[model samples]
Target: MMIRIRSRDGLERVSVDNPAATVAELKFAIESQLRVPVHAQILSTNQNLLLAKAPGDLNKFTDMLDPNARVSALGISHGSIVFLAYEGERTVAGPAFHPSGSFGKKMTMDDLIAKQMRITRQENPHCELVSFDRDAANAFQHYVNESLAFAVKRGGFMYGTVSEEGKVEVDFIYEPPQQGTEDNLILLRDPEEEKFVEAIALGLQMRKVGFIFTQTISQDKKDYTMSNAEVLQAVELHAEGDLKEWVTAVVKLEVNEDGGADVHFEAFQMSDMCVRLFKEGWFETEVKGEIDPKLSRMKKDVVVGGKDVTSVDNDFFLVVVKIFDHQGPLATTFPVENRRIPVSPGALRSHLDRSRNLPFVKRISDFHLLLFLSKYLDVNSDVPALSGCVRAQATVPEGYQLLIESMASAC
Candidate 1:
């Protein structure tokens, strides 16, 4: 008989009969499954994100002498609301709403794991999200070596399996990937797309901008109105090649503070907005933006000769310009910042290699930055090398400027 374990994503059955299996063993197993490392996990019963914890007893942390670890609330109904238990902060059981704000809906598998990430900060320390998927009960049995490979490379393993009860959960040692390894988070930016999403959000914000997200824009003002057709038109136009005048100016959104974040956009500014988005890494970001004054007119991306071309606009909504111009004048390089695992230099070199620009580094900014950097540095760094001098800092390199957490770190 195997020892049954419940994790954040689900539950699992470990084969080790000895309840005294080291925490290190459990961590290793968790790491292999979840892709988190052994060191980044904590043993806290609190649920706080963006904060650090006092270190645990290394021996206790590394050893799994206590077989019955309260890792998670697996084997339960999967719901949109997460029941978060906090110790130092709230010290009570409260509802944790899903980031998407959809209540009582089943999240995608990715969202399900991401949900744990928030709770992982405080409630569940021994958990992580990995890049692979397998039969809930047999991921470990199938990908043990692969899990170890990720453990050695990107970070630690983040794997999990379901219990005999069939709940969706994950288990892993919360090893944070190495800091500053893969750091470049992307954003989504298509004038039409942005307009549609923004319009929907605006509708939500004012009870006047509403097509999706269920949150209605609180404003009942007749001055503001949005419809799916008008929104779709702008997107269609962008997909075609009609509007292309780029306006790269910083539109301030507020005052009483000297910060540069009060940014908003209109359809006329969509071209530059799109550029800003591309620079920010919204290669394939889902369409999101308020409805243009004329959304029904927007077009979808035009594909000619098997290539894609898009138009830009401004009337879509407000485009708050952040970084007008910088010295490097490069677009974003790394899409998101990722942490690495603990491994000697050579053990995971191959894993790191995959992240490198394949087939001569695409991304218009990389091309320009490499050229720009080369003009100041060397030529060889242009093609298959990471120029030591030039870094394609994103226009919005950090996550969201207006928001507390910008995708910048993740980007």
Candidate 2:
């Protein structure tokens, strides 16, 4: 029997020979097979337990605290998923998979050719079109342009709806904590804050649709549409999103014919082959300084235009998607999150005061505002309740109004 274990690294399986294994036996097996020490392991049936940060936090989950408990009694059977947490890092061994010519066998030319990966342009993207809410789009670009001056990279996740026709409508952009340099963007994701964002989106009938990023001015001089680093980052996120229509949008400053700089937006979907290569661990994620920016390095040689090579042109992995703008239902008057300057309660008070003439529901319709309130309100109840009112354009309950006002005034 095999039990799947999900941790920060990814999912791996631990084999158990016994049908009725004890919790102690299961932990022993994990220790021997996965190379994680039994004393350092923290097991839980709840996936959220993996997000626990401290010893005090881990104590809250008592599902697998008793080692004497029987695996069957705990409802852990073959193929059941068990979440894991540990004190330090371990090199997680993935499932057994061998590349071509690795089985102590000599391969014929035809066999090698058959294994060769061919790069071709994807003519059409799965995402038919992507429409951004005018205000939401403006708010994002305005900040990067005005504040950052497009000198450093910045990124965010697009949240909105997808229509039956495969068209994506982006209503908001949630910027996670990140460090951006002139050439690289690193996202420092917050799982706790993301949970609140998810809850708010759930109540407002929306979801994460795509990824958005800005290119620095130094990158504008480059010839490639997207650098190798950018391609790797975008494809990884697209694969993780698991949405066929997921879009990757780039914001940059382009020199117009008038010799003035203009903010430009372009969208693309990673080609199917690109996502497959990323998931299959073919692309070399580590960006070497000597590597060309226009090409992506693969661990093995792949056929590019009938020639075997370790580097493939970045353009081959991109499928352009059409972009449009629309007036969405949500507002963008509230301060955004994950910015250099933290959002304060005074900003919330100012937002409420500025919109005093508007209805309570209208005042709280913005996604940023909802995100702010989500930090204080109950995600399971208060968040959905308030977002539901905004969705239906219904009246905000007096209780919620008072609570929000009190929170705004508390600071």
Candidate 3:
């Protein structure tokens, strides 16, 4: 039997030869196969506890205490996913330095000091301000507010362009496949979905400009606006885009003193210094247990006021620039990925019947609807054919339109 294991390092699979293996035996298998020390490993089926641990409680689950308890009896079976949290660091036996490597021929005290120097504040942002297209912002917020109800986290990529005055105008959003929870967001990207997004961007003359996410209302009670893990995740995404004008936007429900929930939006761009530190491996990547508020602090200047910040003085954010609003092309009438939309069998049939007069690509303007249609469409022919319509912004052929509409109506 194979079990999937997820940790901070990412997902892995481990084989448990014996169906009747005990919990202790499973621990040993993980230690041997995954290189995590048995004593240091804290395994659980609950993913929330994998990252967010309560104060003073080291081991939350008592299942592993009984070494002789069979894993199957404990409800762990083949193909199940388990979460692993470990203490201390795994020691790797390796040479101290490779003589031919970059760090091997180390030099003077000046060189060492240069590497250890702290990242300082920058004076300006590459993006002056990030302006969310009103429709796009409303579309994203509507999903989080109406569907998710501020319970779990949800995230997506911003697609648009930066203006001459350094304002980033986000025209649309493309949410990659992901798993969201109160404390974590794991992106599971689909290549086909990405191709579709690229086609949309190509048609609109936009690019992947920024990232946006929703913070659960539970976080409003916490001290920091963004947790260390959240900061790390946002920075990692920002770094991946490799765009100077990249923005990181967060939407959360803030409780006013009167106990009413107000939807709040904040935006920031990772400072050049912050990006450099991340690229150079200066920021700590391994975050576990309770996050220290100071861990996310850095001396970086941002554009909101453009002052040299010594630390994160406010709960707003560490790298806040500012926010603006605009109007975009897409309508917020249809549902998006990761958002729940109440669709009835009757409504679907009605929509299909109504769309009979229009082309297939135009019939389903929503990406989520397209995703639903993709399951029934042939991957080699129908999928790429429809995707081409998006890429070229061309009219959908009548045959393809009829097929997709029929499939959608049937569903």
Give the candidate number with the greatest TM-score. Answer: 2
For each candidate in turn, the TM-score is 0.16, 0.74, 0.59
Q: lDDT by residue for model 3 over 1-411, one digit each (tens)?
A: 888775554446788898888878888888988788888877777754454556445466665568788878868899886777776654322333221234324223334233224344565678888988888788888878988898888999998887788788887787777888988878888877676666555545678998899888778777776787787788788889768888989999987899888889998776765666567665557665664643554433222232333343233334677888976654444456644444444554655566668655566655445545565666556665665675456888888767865765576
lDDT of 2 by residue, 1-411 (tens): 899886655456899999988888889999999888999888888866766777899988889888999888988999897877777766544334223424333334344333445678999998789999999999999999999999999999999999999999999999999999999999999999999998888888989999999999999999999999999999999999778999999999999999999999999999999999999889999999899999999988787874678999999999999999999989998999989888875998899889999998898999999998898889899888888898899999999999999887876
> Candidate 1's residue-wise lDDT over 1-411, tens digit each?
143333232223334433444445555654564344555544322223212234332223322234354223322121112121112211111123233444333345444333332100112111121111222112222222233321221211122232233221222111222321111112223343233322222211211110011101121121333333222323233333322321111111222266532222111223343333334342333444453322222233422222333322223332322211112222233221122223233322332244436322223222222222222222332222232221223232222222211211232
Q: Candidate 3: lDDT of 174?
A: 74
Root-mean-square deviation per candidate = 27.7, 17.8, 22.2
Relative to the true structure, candidate 3 reaches a TM of: 0.59
- For model 2, name the residue pairs that clash: none
> In lDDT terms, how accurate is model 1?
0.27
lDDT (C-alpha, whole model) for all candidates: 0.27, 0.88, 0.68
Instruction: Give lDDT for model 3.
Output: 0.68
Model 2 stretches with alpha carbons more than 4 Å out: 1-114
Q: Which pairs of residues collide in model 3?
A: none
* Candidate 1 residue-wise lDDT at 109: 44
- Lowest summed-lDDT stretch of 10 residues in model 3? 91-100
Instruction: Give the higher-TM-score candidate: 1 or 3.
Output: 3
